[model samples]
Target: MTEKQREEAEWESINVLLTTHGLKPLCLVKRTDLKDLIIFDKQSSQRMRQNLTTLVEETSRQQSMIQELIETNQQLKKELQLEKCRVVDQEQRANDLEQILESVKSKVSELEDESLNRVCQQQNKIKDLQKEHTALQAKCQYYKKKRLEQEETIAFLQKDIYRLKKEEEERIVTQNRVFSYLCKRVPHTVLDRQLLCLIDYYESKIRKLHKQRYD
Candidate 1:
């Protein structure tokens, strides 16, 4: 049964016992017997008072236990809230990490594109240099052939000068006439122009080759 119902039944049983016993003065033949009865009634009333006090104390203890239980429940609820907050914070951190990862991925993609473009430019520059090197090789060959022809011409001019000197000496010509005739016959201007042209051509070729090599 409920606590209230059980308590009420106990009270009723106690009242019925007290009623059956009847609170009456005892009649006896001696004053000592009457005093003994008084003492017995007083002891019974004292015992009842002690029992009521004990019951009040037990009730107070139960109230204290209930209050403590309520406080503990409140503390537990606070802890649960804190745990929930921690969970939410962790979730937010995870989202932030995801966003950061996405940003890094985007930056990596951009760098990859830029790197590819740079590689293409470098390849094109290399191709152009290769073509320039081939052209320079052809030009060097042409200039080498021309230089050989110029050397042969120079040798022929020297031989002609030697023959002219021998003829002049054999004929015993005047030095002034010989010098004037040699000056008139020699193509000094043409030789100077050819030498200067070759110098210019080689200089140009060297500069172009250097540019292509560096490029």
Candidate 2:
């Protein structure tokens, strides 16, 4: 065959092979450009699928991180509530201690007042006792002086009684001597002696009268 005819026969063979596989006939466009376009489409589809897979994986990781953060927030809120309750308990204890201290202070004040009153009363009692003691001492001294004076007067009176008794005994002895003389001389010298005796008796009477005046 000629060169053009051989070329047509090869094309006919290509067309027959495409028809047998139920493929469409090639268009008028260049084969190389067509092949390049198909390759580009396949590459674009593969890159899109890879990008979608990466995005899904990243989204799932972000969802897990968010869940963990939510759990941590709830735990922090619970701890805060417990701390508030503890503070309230401490405040109540402080209030109770303050009330007890106030009661003790009131008791101390009452005791101090009572002690002051007792001291004042004791001081007044001491003053009154001191005055009474002074009066008693003066009274005792007066009684002691009065007793000394009475003792002196009694001693003087005893001496006077002893002297008066001695005088009376002397007077009795003289009267006894005069009576004996009169009885013995009565018969013999009656007249003259009797007259002399009478005269003597009258003189004795006069002496007795003079002694009485001096006493």
Candidate 3:
């Protein structure tokens, strides 16, 4: 074939191929421009493929990081649950201690009240005892005074009785001697009268001494 016919046949084939592929036919463009365009399209396609590969790698790395974050969150949740349980246990212990403290305080208060009551009772008893002691002391003093007075009176009475006894003895001896003399020298009637008078006087003195001793 001739070169012009060959060129015309190739143009018609390109137009037919463009029409079948749903593209517009080339209009008065040179072969050199078509070659340059093909080369630019190939370079652009290569760059797009390289960018797609880099984007795919970055997406895979992001997915891996997300998976690690999920695992870490699960572990954190478990730890938080354990911490909550520990906090609850500590709170219970604190409550129990508070109750024990209250009980101790109540017991101390009761003991204090009991001790105060005992002290008051003891003080009252002491006061009563002191009053009784004072009264007893007064009675003892009165009794002591009475005893001393009685002792003095008893001593005085003993002395008087002794003197009276001595006087009576002497008087009795003198009367007996005189009566014997009268019996020998005087008459019976005169001796009897004198003896009677002396007897009456002696009886009166004895009565007076008895009255003084008793009083």
Whole-model alpha-carbon lDDT for candidate 2: 0.65
**What total of clashing residue pairs does each candidate reach?**
0, 0, 0
**How does model 3 score by TM-score?**
0.55
Better of 2 and 3 by lDDT: 3
TM-score for predicted model 1 compared with the true structure: 0.48
Judge candidate 3 against the unseen true structure and give its global Cα lDDT, from 0 to 1.
Answer: 0.73
How big is the positional error of residue 98 in model 2, measured in Å on the Cα after superposition?
A: 2.4
The number of clashing residue pairs in model 1 is 0
TM-score of candidate 2 relative to the true fold:
0.45
lDDT digits (tens) for residues 76-172 of candidate 3: 8999998999999999999999999999999999999999999999999999999999999999999999999999999999998998898777666
lDDT of each: 0.68, 0.65, 0.73
Which candidate leads in lDDT? 3
For model 2, the stretches where C-alpha displacement exceeds 4 angstroms are: 1-86, 158-215
Measured against the true structure, the TM-scores of the candidates, in listed sequence, are 0.48, 0.45, 0.55
lDDT of 2 by residue, 33-143 (tens): 343232224544554455456556666887887887887778778877777787787778788888888988998998989999989998998898888888888988888
